[model samples]
Target: MGGPPGPFSVPLRLSPKVLLIDPVRMLPSLLVPLVGVLVVGGFSPRSYLWAAFGLVGTVVFALIRWATFTYEIAGDRVEIKRSLISRSIRTIPLERVRGVDVSTPPMHRLLGLAVLKIDTGASGGDGEATLDGVTVGEAERLKPLLLRRARTEATPTARPEEERHAEGVPSERVIFAVPRRWLLYGPLSGAYLLTPFALAGGAVGLAFQWGDDLGFGRNAAWSVGEWLWQRPSLLVAAMVLLIVAMPIAGGVMYAVFNWDFRLKRRDGYLVAERGLINRRSVSLESRRVRGYEIVDGLAERWAGVVRAWAIVTGLGDSETRGQLLPVVPRADATAVTGDAIGPYQAELRPHPPIARNRRLFRAVFPWLVPAALAGLLLLLTGLTVWWVLLVVSLVMAALGVPLGLDRYRSLGHGYDGDRVAVRSGSLRRSTAVVERRAVVGWRLHQTWFQRRAGVLTLTVGAGAGKGGYSAIDVSEAQGRDFPAEVTPEWLAPFLNPPPGPHTPSDPPSTG
Candidate 1:
């Protein structure tokens, strides 16, 4: 570390602890190479020397990297200088800074260090610049200062402090904090259900490999198989144990990731903090937030829980990038989102009845070909299996009826005040509400069948979130008119042009 020569001009290296953290991070990558060396050495203790050599190399590389890399906030940009043999410099403009993420991995947390990531909203190159390890205090200090300067550069006229004081508002407000009970909603969302299976699969593979190395693989496998074969009931018991373990594992994972999750409004930013072993803090510019999305996975919806994400312009596409609320009750999600971005109060206008037919047709269409094939097979072969296949296909196609109806029921769009909202999907239903000003363009899509059905899909193109939201299978007129209604100044002129100059059919020639 070095003292600033001017305001923030002194080049400073990462904390010394980074040397330790970097090696620990590289440990996983070293596993394959270390194992190969052991295999080549006939699994003898002599291979330990080769492993030690590789570990030393990793340390040396980390040390060189630490010695070479230096960063500083100079003038209007953050500069990163590296390379001893051939110098290289990378600069990120302060005005482009949209968010700052501070995270502490387990190793860093133990050492009281944090990692700082500066998000500049670039679509390429990991979308952020990372400082491997810094003192926790330094990270905390850097986050606000960097964001404040960036916010200042972006909007010179805005005075967040003055505005708050003028309105007699507190500087900080707690928006939402996850409750312990909400962790149960995790398994319902089905996000982490496969985690236990994945871990068990890897662990089983490793265990068998280790047994093989010990020359007991066949004995162990035969013993387990013989034991299970002797007690057939044990198989059913094992299945039941697995059935119970998956949800428990999913809940555990959800708790770990979302432990102590909190969302707060501080100054002019939305700050989120969460995680158990690897703590994370993300600070996003409030002004860049254009909308909010309330998502309902099928099971989560049935359980009356939902998650919310901030539709922030330039937010990264990472898993937790713009997450605002996680697996909370519908009421809680609604309240938090309402307070963050302006509330979405518009009552959605459902699509015309004809759209329902379209949805049902689309849902069942794919199954029809397979069902027909099965029917033909059964007729040609007169086989019982083909008959079963035919029956299964029909049943599957029948299942699509309810799915299509549910999808149609989910589709709707409405606009209220400065916000437009669209809802769609069945399995992972999402209701996105975006500010009118955030919408950059409008698109109307009509397939041949959609046109024949007198409906079209209206895509609302915005600069945030998934970039666009569609009101599927709406009336053609509604699809064309919705954009004009939402952003009249941008689309009305082209869509609803002033009466064209009158041209008489025969009178022009006569004149």
Candidate 2:
């Protein structure tokens, strides 16, 4: 990726071990014939011969695939060519390279092999070009070189590991990693809700199948029903224990999925690596990072922590889900998030407020209407605990009065140099900070009510993370001038940044 030392080309192939380590890709063909032999114990000897033939053919196909797959580095581009049934060749220019991710599954680590992935900022494209079974050192060396070459910069001479820190190269200085205690977040992350149901589906199916095998089909059902009535208290206790166990099960699964999660800021890229069984590593260009989304769900907000994810283009859907800062304290989330995307300050400074009437109307119309209707129904029907229900409903509605006021208080958007930041939300709050240069366009929305109230929803669309973030319910006057203020070209009529020369950004830290 260092411009290839002139116009020469070098072709590379996967390490030999991939034919063994990656046999999972070949499993479907193998499994079909194996299953046939299991079903055909009554059939002739030809069944055995066919199974043998199938195993041999699967191996032959795998070896052929390994032999034909090759990637080459040339003067200006990287080329990958593969042949299985037909031939496919892809050429990616060095300048267009957006990310280089290196991942090592457990087997790959045992054999010291890794897969290096390259992503270009194009939609509907295959996520990356993968070179499987490469050595760890090669992946480490190539990730940064790919980004540097894409920037058309000269490759710096390699230095010792300890001395390289000051070179502004993306070296291994850990930014944020999952702490052992962070496992607390694991239980709250749908462990109780989804995990138990998933567990029940598989468990109930297996239980019925075993009951049928044991000739206890109807008897098993009757026994459980009989026990529920006979030992009601014991059954209730068991149910309580099961309910308590679900989140723990979910938390364990979550820990396994995100075990050993580590994040790093490289010279010109941000890298993340996580997973226990099926491990993955992702490296994204810092230059392509448009912004950061500091997200807090109700539980996360209660814990006073937030998660951060990169808002970048051409990275896979998974990375956009905030692998950058999976779960960190609010302070760390802010500092690391700003570093991930260049020149951001995740502050809570005030911007223009939405009209007070909007909040007032929202509080009354949405909350009071439903509460009043439900309360009236309870009264008219004379339902049990009708008075209690009425009280609870009114309390909930009254709570919204303050919530509406807080929602208005949280509404703000401002600029710091070329970056525009917006903070909005009441329950699950988010502060989205994006660079002005990254803004591709603006989307303005006004409902009949919003129009009458002099506020509008201004969505800033960028090439990165989920494509857009809204500056919800800003004053119409501010919404009209917002784009021009952030990036003049985004507005049709523009007073472009008072014609002045711009200085270059300093080299970012290797945090």
Candidate 3:
């Protein structure tokens, strides 16, 4: 496939399997026409002809796209050429290649096909270009050559023999994979809890939108509401059915999304690839990964499970930013973090360097806004049922207080010669770790309350992962002394000069 890789040029068409993948991806676009045909079929037989025409149009389009798309690696750039109406050539320099993400969906895997997405930190478009369907073998060969500089040892004394493959055995290690038992957590992770409410609300909204067309007059809405109000048993059954259906749907989604999920440590980057139907692979260069965000929600924490995400720039969009590791035991997550970044203590030790009670109050106080609003509503309209809602809101605020307190308790900052760490959140706890070397700048911020309380947030700025991590509500002295302690010489000019003039030997002068 493409002349044995290694910077050779050859025109390659997308795998024929794309004919299968494209139609499914285009389902949403095809639905409007499909619905139109169904509506017209009620009046005439011409609808069948229209449906056949649409089907032919979609398949021909996907075919034309597959035929036109071709790419080659020649010189220092990987070039992609494609066209349906207008032809265009997009060239990405090898050195500018930040990452090459390759994914294999279930269908793709069966076909031995994969998608190659090239992200060059392009300002627009999630990625520069994607070769939607390509041979897995070709992708493997090209991956090493494209990322050769990145994967190789930086030392000048590095040997030719060290090239993981200039000979072809990629040093890919499995970082993690989803365990079968964790499937239960999948429903909990997704929309299962809220699915019933969302589905019910959506049904009501849609019914209102198309009621007249469906021969349900405007008065039909109020009539249905009255019927539901009169029949508590029927409403409960419907709710129970929705609730029961939600978990099943959530479980299905979970299985589909996390099927064969794997995180692989490969030449110079970490690749997270998963999915059953529409698989995705995201590659994060080690250098661009300034830090890692460890996520553990209340339930996951209770279950002793934790997940981590790569905190990298440019992949800020939630969909593209790949999770660094899968849902594994909390202990395992820690061990992996230590292995990948370095030994992080707040993770190992946990629950230290807590924010003061005032900070805890500040955190918990904001959650009461919903309860307050509910009370106001109850006062204006003395509905008996609203009392139940107000009670629930207050109960939630009560539950949230401890969670908020726990979040404040989770606030911690530490450094151990190589890395600086910050931990925050309780309901959804996160610990960010950045190498001391990756830090580009330091900033200390103090609000009026913080000033009065003698505390400030110490912000550590780096090139990766949203650019900054703050040590929330840290003591003033800690904030002032942190930069000097961590990156000593770099921030000395902006901060106090390392106490040179004020050294103990020269401290005799009161002036």
Candidate 4:
């Protein structure tokens, strides 16, 4: 019989095309040095020669890297070995694998290549590794091989589904797909709305830096300002156009990033596929999914749109990885959450009315301080601008009442069957649900004001997404009993025994 196998028995190499891809990936690192050379050496032949040398060096380094890197599925573990001088080997047990992400950037897609990322679901992201350049077929092949053992082990009872999925057949079914109209929620998400502005600011900053380097920054800035001052109507038109473009730009980016978004489910995994320029597909093991979180940004709530994500264990850091449903109508989000996790329709229990008072007081107090400060400043300096500031601060304080009411309305917690749900927040309202079994601990927090108000905050701790979800400002009674009701095994024993019959004990008489 042949000897068992060598250390690199079935070693696999990345696509040779990595020679081109790797160098391009390293080009960003060469920028600063190249720019420095150009700045110091000017556009002379010497600078060009130095730039060429750098490019050659980058290409050579890429070649060495490509030659050294090799990965393989050896036994029950996936092994990756790389580095030219100091060889390093990384081994991941098949059983610990929780997810696999495959992404194809525009360049990779053009070259028919993909990048495979292994997610071992380590809380610290220590076991995660990315294979940057692989043929599309190889990525697909490796994905299944790496995750197959994990899926089988996770769901030993799911024999039929596992068998079908293992054969590379179409065993998966679509749970939800984002409609194009739903893209309207993109602007309401509030993230994309500022993205264009942020990019513009960054570009402007870079332009100013370059202008300064070339010695015309101040003059250019002054000229632009003077020109804008000269043509006030033109400036106004430009401002209007910019305001109009923000939402449009946000919508476009959202669509491009999430075009044709689809959530599908196989036997033991939830598969999410999306992206336009950079197509991405991630497979998350269903067994580790604890529950669901529904988020409503302030604008999204006003628009009646929301987003949902699976609360999964060991997901770690990347919010996109747990996305169960992107921005959509509240009804659609509810359905997706129900389908992703188990269905629950229990009405959330509201907190005491005192809690509402607390919310309102807390909300307005911030603006009150500023308004008071501005009023004091105005009185002391008699400045018109300070008066205007005082007026604005008062108006903001007035606005806080409605915000406080909304936040109060958002605060609720309830339990149905074995699941507990808590909703809170104003700026980014979120409703988080977790199975009773998933409750790792319960924490009670009461500030001096809250204690005087007979209310406390109860935080539910779990091992999954975000780790802790709080039911802010509940009655002291609810704080004591709610946790015990949800997680009797852990909290019930710790509960204070019901007060013994109103005992009237004699007080000490000694001085």
Candidate 5:
């Protein structure tokens, strides 16, 4: 056999430079020195020596193996070749490549290296095959090349704007970045990182104080309060420090991660790019998106911010999926939404007073159970002298009315040609939009209690993961008409059958 066919049928070469990162493989090497230090501090010297020898051997072997691995972009394909004992090769066509993501962990940042991930949309999925170490400059240079390749392989079509008005589909647009301030003030502000820090610090301080009280350490005389007092100025300084440092740090991180975020009009596609030290970009074709939703909380409303997200297929395996724009001004929500979903407007529908009557008796009313339980415990334990359960039940019932009213006010659905719109919320008001062709199914339901009250509920289902259902409770009369009035023109064929030729149109020419 002639040299077993050299890797590829054509001659190929890679750049001489190779970036090396031994993330988990470097763990044993790091542990050896710590073990040696402990051994010097009066432990087993022989054990330390053996461990060191093993670690060194492993590190040397890893380095050699890693050095033998190489990759190259040749013609319209990517070639990866690596071997220590048994050789292996992988070739990916250019068309299969989705995008490349480059990340720099803190350690990699210090070393001026980045993790270059080639997302090939392989059967293995996104972030599938990654080369974990490359210089920042090299990663950047490689990005355009990979994106260009993906673009070249992609089919040419109409501009995003033109595609928005395409028949049987609601138009959608992509937004890359909103103001950094909005992100910080909105969803990002609620990030749970601070809660853990607060809890951990409190626990540690409490443990230290308890240890001191037990005379465990003579030097540990400080309580958390005393410690704070000792550094009174420092505590104040720390508060001031966070106040100033947080926004700057957050803004910088947001800017970098979300840097070069561009929302563009591509035919039937929405593309989003965000990452700070590590960059990520996503492209969602129209068919992959299930629906659109608007999220508005009290904070969002007070800040004039509104967030929008979509139910997407194959995108949100991570926590960051489901959102196209994590936060934006409420005013901008409409415009940006219109851009993404062409020519659809929100309309409010009035609900009859009877429609809301059942809300007071259903799940919303059951919150009284918790309040009543707490109050009964207080009374029985002699914690209070009053008939607290009665008082608590009254208070809960009072709150339920407003809750019911808000739900009633917030519920509505409308259709513009083949597009469907439904709005609902009590605190975080929201509107969901979907095209008729996009609806997978629908259902009408009535609980036994609802039937007794002469009311029914309807839920509209779509294909996306999160915002798939739009539900509302209405009077029985309204329920009967709801499907016909809201069904989009494109979906009418599916919802109802054509009238048969023999079906009577009039009352038998009625007289």
Candidate 6:
């Protein structure tokens, strides 16, 4: 039996048209080794024999299998016939198709081919499956057909006017383009400054190689040291120069690579296109967006650059889960988020105050342990022994004061009618919004330490495939009442009820 399908035979020729992808260009990837032998002059006479064998073998394989790779657009079902030996055939109902994406990599671009990926939402698995090595033009034509079929099948009983309006209306679209200056300043400049250190390191290695070639007999190390010593001042100056140059260079590179990055909105979708050497474009529907967040590092924060990203439910796998947008300017985050999420933007709540619990020690008293240990060691060494403990305690208290203040400053939360929002971070800030209906369960716990302090923690659980709410500390009084108030009555049954005395006391056990 033939091993598997190779694009060759035309199967079931009934179609808008059966467009045969050019196979000659694809044949190169299979023939490179044979060509390599002839070019390298290794057994030149035998090279022709190998090349001929390779070509004929590949062609025969392609022809036998091509008949198995066929796609028939019959009514609303897309029948994909693939495989050669086992001959597996599958059909995807048009109504279940969620979205389609088309990508053209550099190699595919050269051959005018494109890869079409179809995402059938969560039911289809983690993400989409791809059909690659199709002609670019054919893939483009297939997009509209798939989209039309999906839309019609999804809502087949629409009125004639509604159908006409749907056809006439343009789809919502958004483009993500980075500003040119930022890209030039960020990563490009960094590479330029780093080149010098690389050059110097290369020169040192080459000098050792030259010594070996001239039969210097292992004295190259001393020669290398002597060379450096002779230019000690110059060496020191060069080291200082590089230390100052790298960051500047890095900034330029970041600016150049990210320049002209723009996210545009059209119809009901968001489209992202980026890259300097190689361009890429991607599009996704707005309804598929589960949530989005803004991220900022210290430098990015001070520079007022905020990166925006989204949590798309079924579009990503383990490696790419929850990554929707790349980093963009902080100023653009709000506008872009609002546009993409539509009316749901109102449900985008800020984080609650309890989320700031971790920041109390992390940000406020980072040096407390180190400082106390140093004082204790000095005291044990008989230096300032009497006052060391008192001094350390006082210093720790001073640090704790500010820690508490900043913790309070960073804590906050809000809720829209249908969604809950929580915000918390120390050096970095993050805000999360979860739909109320998405919450499947919740719990309230009180640890001994928290109970003594009159505080308790709350945890919220959502649907599978989404992370649950972590233990967030809040006033014990507030915790007892939070679950009942935040969770709907429908979800209340799913929650573990608070422990209490049995209303119907059990009869005393008979001995």
Please give the CA lDDT of all the candidate structures: 0.83, 0.70, 0.71, 0.83, 0.60, 0.54
Instruction: Quote the lDDT for 264 in model 2.
Output: 71
Preferred candidate (lDDT higher): 2 or 6:
2
lDDT (Cα, tens digit) per residue for candidate 3, span 1-511: 2323445646777778779878777877777667667675863668877877888888888888888888887766788897878999988777677777777767788788987777777644466778777889887777766676565434342223224533455567776776777777766554455666787899888777566544455578878999998999998998789778888877777777777777777655677777778777777766566567787777778888877877665553423555766667878777776655456653322332335566556655665776787788889998877777778767766876676667767788788777888877776777788877778898889898778777788888977766788778888778866678888887667655345654664445777
Superior by lDDT: candidate 3 or candidate 4: 4
User: What is the lDDT for 163 in model 1?
Assistant: 57
* Candidate closer to the true structure by TM-score (higher is better), 1 or 4: 4
List TM-scores for all candidates, in order: 0.87, 0.75, 0.80, 0.89, 0.65, 0.61
| C-alpha root-mean-square deviation, each candidate | 4.5, 8.6, 5.1, 4.8, 7.8, 9.5
Winner on lDDT between 3 and 6 is 3
- With a 3 Å backbone cut-off (N, CA, C), the pairs that clash in candidate 3 are 165-168
- In candidate 1, which residue pairs clash? none
RMSD of 2: 8.6
Cα deviation in Å at residue 163, candidate 2? Answer: 15
Off by over 4 Å in 3: 1-7, 20-28, 34-47, 106-112, 123-125, 152-169, 188-192, 195-230, 244-249, 278-280, 313-321, 345-354, 363-401, 494-508
Candidate 4 or 5, higher lDDT? 4
Q: How many backbone clashes does candidate 6 have?
A: 63
Q: How much is the lDDT of residue 122 in candidate 2? A: 64
User: TM-score: which candidate is best?
Assistant: 4
For residues 1-511, what per-residue lDDT tens digits would candidate 5 score against the true structure? 1112232455332222332346354775466455545555465776667666766776677677666677766666667777878888887765455545556675677667777666543334446556666677776666544444323333334444534434324444445456555546533433332443455468767577546544454355455457888888988886676655555565555565555555644434566666656655555554445467787775556677776776554443423434567667766767766766554654655555666776556535686776677677776785554456657676877888877777777778777766677777767678787776667667788888777767667677775544365556666666666666665464577655566698654444545
Candidate 5, poorest ten consecutive residues by summed lDDT: 11-20
lDDT by residue (tens digit), candidate 4, 1-511: 2222433467988999878788888887777678777777877999899999999999988889889999988777888998899989998877778788889999999999999988877745533878989999999878777777654453553435555665555477788989888887798887887766688688768667666765565678667768888999997887787788889999999998988999988756888899999999988887788899989999888899898888888885448788888898999888877876676679999999998898899888888888899889888999999888888888988998999999999999999977889999999999999987688998999999888999998999998888999999999889988976776776544453444578335543778
Model 1, which residues run further than 4 Å from truth?
A: 1-6, 42-48, 123-127, 150-162, 165-170, 203-240, 379-382, 495-511
lDDT of 2 at 357: 54
